[model samples]
Target chain A: MEIGAEAIVQNQTPKRAAVTTGADRPGRRPSSGRFRRLNVLVGVLSIPLFIILWELTSRSGIVNMVLFPPPTVVAAAVLEWMRSGQFFWDVAASLYRVTAGFLLGSALGVLLGILTGQFPVVSSLLSPLFQILRPIPPIAFVPIVILWFGLSEAGKLFLVVWGVFFTVWLSTHIGVQKVDRGLIRAALMLGTPRRQMLQEIILLGALPYIVVGLRTAVSISFYTLVAAELAGTFAGVVYRIEIAQQNLQTGQVMGGLAALGLISFIADRLFAALAERTVWWR
Target chain B: MSGYRSTTKLALASSQPSVKTVSEQPAIQVSNLSIVFDTNRGQMIAVDRVSFDVAAGEFVCIVGPSGCGKSTVLNTIAGLEVPFEGEILVEGSPVGHPRPDIGMVFQQPHLFPWKSVRRNIAHGPRMLGKSAKEAGAIADDLIAMIGLKRFADAYPNTLSGGMQQRVAIARALANEPRVLLMDEPFGALDAQTRAVMQDNLLELRDRIKATIVFVTHDIDEAIVLADRVLIMSAGPGRILREIAVNLPRPRSSAILIEPTYLALKRDCLEVIRAEGLRAFNQSDSS
Candidate 1:
């Protein structure tokens, strides 16, 4: 890639600003621009470096190619999976599970969180239940889920929902609790009608935290998906990985891991993009 | 300056003898008002026995120390807080709960983040059974009057603090309320912005010909904006003294530098100063 001189000049105004200020101004736009650029460069360079090291290790026989496989082999397997439509099916299945689970869990979480956060009586009543159950991991609930719903997609979905619920619920509850008292007072003094008070002041005040929780919930969905798949079904990418490990196809196992990582990254990026667009006011 | 000039023009035009006959009724009447809040320990008197009548089209400022319950008085009048004693009668009827006829502004702008400036301003009008067309017109007029026409569509976050408060003022006026209750509405702003907002408020008050009960801790602010300044004592907050600021109509920022303005400020300070000293002595002893 040829670097344009104007592009370099555009970038180097920071070089001018840096020499001018004795120390960089913190959190200011132009001052942070340099660090942002550096982070992007570091991120872009990481994959290539990993691939090069893998190829070098394969060629030098430092690691057996048959055991670990090179990046090219993994890429080829990914391409074959895509060609066979198995990759799309697996991705679609994972996406559906995450979407259904997160939406169901977060909807319930927000409603309960808002109710608890607003009224002290409600909070006290629910806090005990949350405290007791919150310590039990969603993975631990897999047995109960299976017992209740059978060892099927329903059980897997239940596990994922349970995993995401507490995360979103706690964040929203804390958010509503910590809403700026001044803002609430302002609304009340303005003679805001009672019914609209929660919707306008409380919920909107808690929105930024809810969004952060929603972002965190995506990670929880992936966590629960892999765990539930590993424990329950004889299908899903995790199941395929388990089967591959049993048959001693290490490359196929790594391939499954790569798919999981890709799905998580893409989903997170999409969610973050939505949040940035939606909650710019915060 | 343009703001006050327009207000003067409106006042002149609306000061017809027939107009006084048409709207001679008092906007708000607070008779024997007192507020006591029940905290965890016991009943705490926030506002002690107080009574005042705000005539239609008068600007009143209640000034005191930080904990003097100036805000409690405003909240009581607004019907947000129930007073332990006394009646706040608006237009000859007691205020039992919040009504659309009363508008309030607070220290924080409190503009809803989800709504644009225009939408926030239009909220009260729309809530009061006005059509979108009517609400939009009122919102537009208020926005223009507050000098925020250019920022009508902007979200609250995009605006400066002063601009956000301007939107808040516009929002309050949209209700076409008979009275405006403000509780340290400009106290949160920087000194420069606060000064500008004070000017804007006084100008708006003059133009609207609406009764305003403004609460603030700053004596200079009280003298600058008030037609009558009421000084309050702390702890079981009670009105200590009331002074009619007899400065000429359409006062400006330059009025603050006048000897009379300074004298009035000192008098108001003396009232709050005694309370301040007593508070400090109590704290020191404790």
Candidate 2:
């Protein structure tokens, strides 16, 4: 009996090994960590290529160096501005306006968007007004904004708020509207109360869209920020660019434009990073 | 014949107590329930005066054709849909709105993609004002019960379709509801996975003893799981017939091969076949 049991076990071992190998062969699993590292490498490689192209274009004189400065020259300007703390002030001012307006507008937009999405009558009544208003550019509002509120911080801030608000609002509305009906039913059946449904179901369902909207609006914030400071400000990066233009300081003008581009790029990258961390669940 | 007589004796014994107290209510009393949907063509009746009493801890299956309103009845019971006429009473109270006393599992897993398996299971308690710690305990217990303890922290997207639906089942049971409404929960899974799920469901039902109202179009599924099967008509859905399964307790996939189980399955298929053929003929005439 013992010898027979041992023979059976020995036969099964090879059979089990064969079966396991056959199963593994069908679905060839690759390591995900390698794919992620490859993506990061591709992104890092693009930065140097961009700088090399900028230097080549400037050296070739295809476009005036005054109009489009080389990346090295812009790097030098960045260093000079950094040492003098002029870069710090410009960054601080821009960040302050964008952050404040973005927060205020987003909060209101999210609230109203959720309401309109949930309530049919509210959505019907408010959708048309928003649809008409959304198409009107934030920059177009600059003249009227200045006339109404003056060229003070309020005027610029209002434009930024308006810009971020509609984007966030529209995305949020779409998000809530498109939430899976089945999931809602599942939640309801599980005894999720009506008042808590928005936070538990609606907001969570709309999170991915909200993140996308917020990230997109970061670029809009920069747009409104630049336009806001261009006409009225005695300070700000745009104002400094205007000063350089008036003085006919080609390098400084290019430098200021480069600074704006650099700041916009950094802001976009920051938003992307924040979105990745916050919306891992999404 | 002996089994039938025994079932009749059991029914009589149960009803004898009710004779003294006819006014006493069932755990779930669905009476004259009808649901109508307004379409471009006209008013369509989905459920037509479907009345049934689900005694506490009874395992019932609502079986019918694909278009039959078995799911609609479950929805009405769950308080997700308001019946056009009649009413549903749960524990002597009319079900006017959704409450946690009833839990539901859908055909699709419907687990939140973002939450881990554990978090999805815990969502019910979290919503019910339980502390995170308390909810976590319930979640852990349920995850273990579903044999998914290893995958508790894994996201729903990372799991297979069967695993996702298993998580959904665990999530529903996490609240420890009195009545569990399952709308073709195994319908989305492959044949092998579905067999495993059916066995798991029977085991869970035996252990938990929660009143289950399962909806399915598969006759074999109806035979294997249900203590009683309610067959429904299509379109304006209504309970056409009720058949007691009367199979032995503690059923598993092997029960399918039993002679009595096969006979009952054939009986169910004949009824569904008649309804299906009738529907086809009517549609053809139109």
Candidate 3:
């Protein structure tokens, strides 16, 4: 237990350089202490500072309060939307589309990526097609999607999935290809058979890249969700924003945007934490 | 089984009338092997008709200059590289792919980063269909032999370079390979650590029954560990000479300071210097 615990502690120190170095360095000075304190203070005050500037400008006869609503108006509008229970439905609808699309798209992307990456024949057949299709923006498909599926939920899912698939696919393909040949040779010398080679060596080797691709796809999923709901949706955060914008309810529009930003920010942070655990050896 | 094998051989000999080299039954054989590479400047010969044999349980070192294909020859024996011509036979079977009975340790430790020391060592046995408990038992034995008992559960990144290489050697031996191919396993270490590892390997070799074929450019390393040294020349690698080190068994790094050791080193250096001058003169004339 001592050895195991000691090893774990040693392994953790270098890994936590970002958090440890700021506190652990020996050359701490009084002026540097003040500078660090100032940095923390600024970080805490950042949102408030921006909100205060917006409020001052809106009320100081510099801008129309209705058109350029401040933080208080946006907060009040969000509260009202929550009270009406429409916020819950909007959030749920948007979340469902993003989650479902991400999972399906990520699954297909990983499958196809491994196929193309590991097998040259499959790569020769499909990579050129994926390359041609990848650059076309998902939003450009919105008009054609309406023609094909007529504002259905499937069309929305398609848009979100399309947004996510190519990124994960390409990253996975590259990751698989980039798996260290040294590791592969080492494994083969250990009597690993062909099929087991993929499972025991290739998958874990490429996982870091796949996790990175998935993280990028997280933001992409959100981007495409907005396009999907804006094209047409009965209830979604972006759909609510569209309706509020049409009615000149700039406060709700701003509130919806803020909510979207907050969600995306939390999601990114959560995935970053998960990514740390995924490639824990790093 | 021997009777049946001889009968089959007799039948095959009668049917084809093939030429068979009747010689000592060696553990590993590389006869007239050649490896060519397709370069930007057309085809280049990497190893040209190089041949050698290792008797059962013998430790052999192949020493040469950088780019002399010493590592290529070792890889061919490990079935990691295909010879352009000629064949490599290990344990009387034609070498084609990496077999469980063959183990290898590369210059870089190349430990699986995610695995603990024990798991890394256990991987060979586990891949060969040993149960988890059985593999663990085997790994623990090697861990003890390598003197890394305390760090059994340590990930590769936490260990020092020499420690990692010790683990690599242990991992390779978990399958009890008959022939172990080492390509500069200690080359990356500092002088002190390298000396320590060499001593450690000498001690470990006395206990294991594996035949070892080690490749190194270091002349002292070749003499200290190997029962026989195969000196190779560069630019289309060819065996220049063979020197058998008659040093007593159970030797240590301390033996490297002996007068006999110096004489052997001088002999090896003389051969290499002569080969170098020849290559240099050839290049100058060209």
Candidate 4:
């Protein structure tokens, strides 16, 4: 009976192999290639198609032109803003806030994260406090920040820093905790001193996680920037948008929003490129 | 296997004589070593009164079934295991913390992924306060010794399993430790690669004068590598017997076919089978 079963299996094996090989033959190749090409074509046309539809709707009286202006009108307003030279200053102001706040927040986050992750005593003291604060949205603190700083740059910086700090801290903490025990044992066996263990092994082990946290904080800095500007800023992209909104310059307001989105997108991409280099071995 | 036999023969032919010395104190002395872990089921004994002494420049293999606390014994000797009832003296000093004279290789390579092969090897020397130049020189020497000179700058992730294990061994030796502890270092490799690694290790062992204690479940590996093979039984690990392999030096996996080797292997199998049967009966009765 076993021999007969084996014979049946042997007979079916060639048929199964033939069917799979037939499916992989050259006759099926062009359809897959054509499908991939069609996907690329659709992807290339996606943004342009959306813009054209938006423009058509605005101009064809389907929407209020003043409120929902076309992309061309927004572009012209941006060009006008650039011609006046205020665009550069607005970008510089916003860039300065994001950069300063991100650096300060990331530094603090990493420091505290290493402290809490390494020592259980420190973790016991700080983790509970952090857990409480981490869930409260950074935007919610804007009103309180305004009351405290009264439109000062300190308040704006505080908002952005608060937004970035928790993300970086949590990831760094988890990363340090998740560092392989085998690696630690190996390092210990190699006579790695306690101080050097933290500096060399622990820090580098947690770096990949820290980079991930910092990347997340990049987008978060933009989110908090919105809150900070709305709270009250002298000059920033969001501030310009607010001013345009009040003056009823809908095109300028739309242009400001576009500029903000572009900056955030660029920041995310730049950090992603940097992150790849940061964890170079990956 | 046949391809590596020639290289093994060549390595043995060119290898220097063993530097085994009759020093006053043994390289490692473990007396009455016991470890207890507080698991969900009250307290469980991991190692029970395990005692052994490895002589200077001696190669010893501890062979046992999995969860036999053989690794725990190795770790305790390396000063990585704590809160255990034991007196482990390495070179006449009681083991408490990881010392510079001791080096260990784990089951996994555990090579710092961020570091290149050269840098990973240099890490031990650098931590010991050797200057970058000195550390680099040491790393380069070991890299050449391991025959991975071409891949000195390559990262661990890029290397094959056997190659990574070689680098790991080189890294452990970078400090020129007096005693080296290895816990199933080639257990993760395929059989073919494992044979090659064993041959490479035998060749490398000829040059380095460090006392080595290797742990494995493979009786064949233990016999091929060690001057003394310590057989251990699990369920609160304890040594069952110690068999001395009187095989000639500069040996490799090629000796598996030899009459004396087969006799020694039969002895080890009888001991292990008796232990396994006893444990099986005890568990069944329970």
Residue-by-residue lDDT tens digits, candidate 4, B89-202: 999999988988999998899999989999999999999999999999999878877888789999999888888999999999999999999999999987877888898898
Local accuracy of candidate 3 as per-residue lDDT tens digits, A1-282: 224445877998877985776678747667798999999999999989999999888888888988998888889999999999999999999999999999999999999999999999999999999999999999999999999989899999999999999999999999999999999999999998879989888999999999999999999999999999989989999999999999999999999999999999998999999999999877
The CAPRI class of candidate 1 is acceptable
1 or 3, greater by TM-score: 3
Clashes of each: 0, 1, 0, 0
lDDT by residue (tens digit), candidate 2, A163-220: 9999999998999998999888888877688788887888889888888888888888
Clashing pairs in 3: none
Q: What is the descending TM-score order?
A: 4, 3, 1, 2
Local distance difference test scores for all models: 0.81, 0.82, 0.90, 0.91
Per-residue CA lDDT of model 3 for B1-286, tens digit only, reads 0123234443443354111222368889889999999999999899999988888778899999999999988888888886468988899999978999999999998899988999999999999999999999999888988888889999999998888999999999999999999999988987878888898888677667778999999999999999999999999999999998988766888988999999999999999999999999999999
Predict model 1's lDDT versus the native: 0.81
DockQ leader: 4
lDDT value, candidate 3, whole model = 0.90
Off by over 4 Å in 1: A1-43, A119-121, A181-192, B1-25, B39-42, B273-286
Q: After superposition, how far is residue A257 of candidate 3 from its true place, in Å?
A: 0.5
What local lDDT does model 1 show for residue A242?
80
lDDT of 2 at B107: 94
Estimate, for each residue in B1-286, the C-alpha lDDT of model 1 and write its tens digit.
2544366556774564311233556778877888888899999988888988777777889988888888888887887786469888987788867777788888788888878898888888776768889989989878878877778889999887788888988888888888888989888887777887887777676567567889998888889988789989888788889998988766766698999998888888887788789878998999
Per-residue CA lDDT of model 1 for A1-282, tens digit only, reads 012434766799988888766466545777588899999999999989989998788868788888888878877876776788777767777778888999998998888889888889999999889978887878888777778987788888888888888888898999999888766655654556668878878888898899999899999999999878877675577777787788877777789999889889999999999988868665
Among these predicted structures, which one has the highest lDDT?
Answer: 4
